[model samples]
Target: MGPELHYQMIISRTAELRTEAADHRRVRQVEAAKKERSEGGLRRSLFGKFSAA
Candidate 1:
């Protein structure tokens, strides 16, 4: 393949890989936040029960 064609291919592939990585990172952050919220809620509930008793 011509050098220009090869260069273009590499650039496009790199861009696609970066996009995929960013999406994965966003998903992981969202999952972590959700887990933290759920754990926090559970802690609050347990604390409330203990305090009540």
Candidate 2:
């Protein structure tokens, strides 16, 4: 509607983008950590079974 309103909208959008990016990054970090833990557990279990055999 006005110049000030347009500027405010732009700033609001930038903030939303930053917040979304941070959330995405956190989700990825958590997923990667879980994957690493799962792989580590599998490796240990397999190693134990092989060693016993």
| TM-score leader | 1
Model 1: residues >4 Å from true position, as ranges? Answer: none
Question: How many steric clashes between backbone atoms does each model show?
Answer: 0, 0
Candidate 1 lDDT tens digits, 15-34 = 99999999999999999999
Stretches of model 2 off by over 4 angstroms after superposition: 48-53
Q: Which ten residues in a row have the lowest lDDT in candidate 2?
A: 32-41
Q: What RMSD does each model have against the real structure?
A: 1.1, 1.7
- What TM-score fits each model? 0.86, 0.77
Q: Residue-wise lDDT of candidate 2 within 1-53, one digit each (tens)?
A: 99999999999999999999999999999999999999999999999999999
Model 1 poorest ten-residue lDDT run = 1-10
TM-score of 2: 0.77
